[model samples]
Target: MSSEQRVLHTPDPAERENLATFLSRALRLDQAAVVRLRKRGSSLVSAWVATGFETLAVRTITAELGVDDVTVGADTVLAGLRTGHPVDLGYSMDSAWRGALPPMDGFAHVDDVPARALVELAERGADLAREHGGVHGPPASLLDQSVLTVTGADDLEVQVPMRVVFALTAMDFIPHAGEKAEARRIQPTELVRVRATRTWLRLDARYGSVARRLGGGIPLSPS
Candidate 1:
């Protein structure tokens, strides 16, 4: 809980750059955003941010953070990384995260959808938003509509909102049409995994994951 900026280390340049990209996306979504860093174990740290669309985004990377959990300003960490400044994450915003982190375990495997499918859905959502949105952006009905529903074992079904898809693309979680020709040429048939608990629904993409409240009991099954 130090007011002073704290330092950490990520020796691998690739991982550091990836983290930088995630933080930058978060800042772009909400300029006053904060990133919560939670050590997953001895090797990886989960960096989480609240996507402005009622969802949470996380990108876990390997690093030596020396601590278990802390929250800091996204812009501060991004600046430190850009300037080679020892990842001096400034001003512990421990209280900034106002919601509970999803449980690391116990999520039921609901289904898997193609990454390309998700990318396409996001694109269509954007077009619809642009056509109908105004000063306040897309209408709540569009954002909250159940655009997709996947059924799973034990009679489980969940509806995915356009806002979730928007958050996914906004965070650059899934690969899409804008990749370089070289990257597009080798785009793998990666799948976006869907999982859920009684309280939340999560979509895991190539780069990160986005989750939001289910607004009802999951599974729609008997207890």
Candidate 2:
């Protein structure tokens, strides 16, 4: 890591808040989580973290990272974002990241599911999880269960797992019911995109994205 790369600046001054919120949320999910910041083009950077359900949560914000990529403790980055200073991100944890990122393109938009519907599904799943959860939390069967299936043009079909919905709501990607809003949490027309590559299934929510590989982190691709 170079001195210049340690510096973080939002493309539009307000984006720092979004980046900080992202890191903080990721940190809460995994206390020891490391954040992967990959610079995209000259104006955007994508920050990703494993959401502990074998899915990756990603948020892209405008920024200048000075380097193409770097990994740092999400907690540290959160603090840096809050303090508005050049943070000592410490050592690069590029090696700590253990999986492949999905292709930037090549995803076919299989279908669109109403955000409100998915939120309802997540609520029901949460209730079930609490009723059946043990020392390890929700059972793999429940989380892995396919809750919805979409078949689009060309006979394309995608089965969305409960885990994707869980990850989305857990990250506050789509505001939940109890969460108050001037209007509805998600508008009736607001939809979460369900896209797929041969190897990945992606859910693009308003705030961020939750991806499970057709099958892993980003379980939802075959590893």
The candidate scoring highest on lDDT is 2
Q: Over the stretch 1-223, how does candidate 1's per-residue lDDT look in tens digits?
A: 5544256678788888999999999998899999988888888988989897888899999886756788889988888777754687766887667777777878899999877676677778888989999999999889888888988999899889888888887898865554521224325687889999878899998889998878721232321
The residue-by-residue lDDT of candidate 2 on 1-223, one tens digit each, is 6765666676454788888888888878889999988888888889988898888899999887777778778988888777766555666887778787887789999988899888889889988999999999999999999999988899999989999888887788875456542125667888889999888899998889988887644432222
Instruction: Give the whole-model CA lDDT for all candidates, comma-separated.
Output: 0.81, 0.82
Give stretches of model 1 more than 4 Å off: 2-5, 177-188, 216-223
Residue 57 lDDT in candidate 1: 95
The TM-scores, one per candidate, come to 0.87, 0.90
Task: Provide the lDDT at 214 for model 2.
Answer: 72
Backbone clash pairs in model 2 (N, Cα, C under 3 Å; residues 3+ apart or in different chains), count = 11
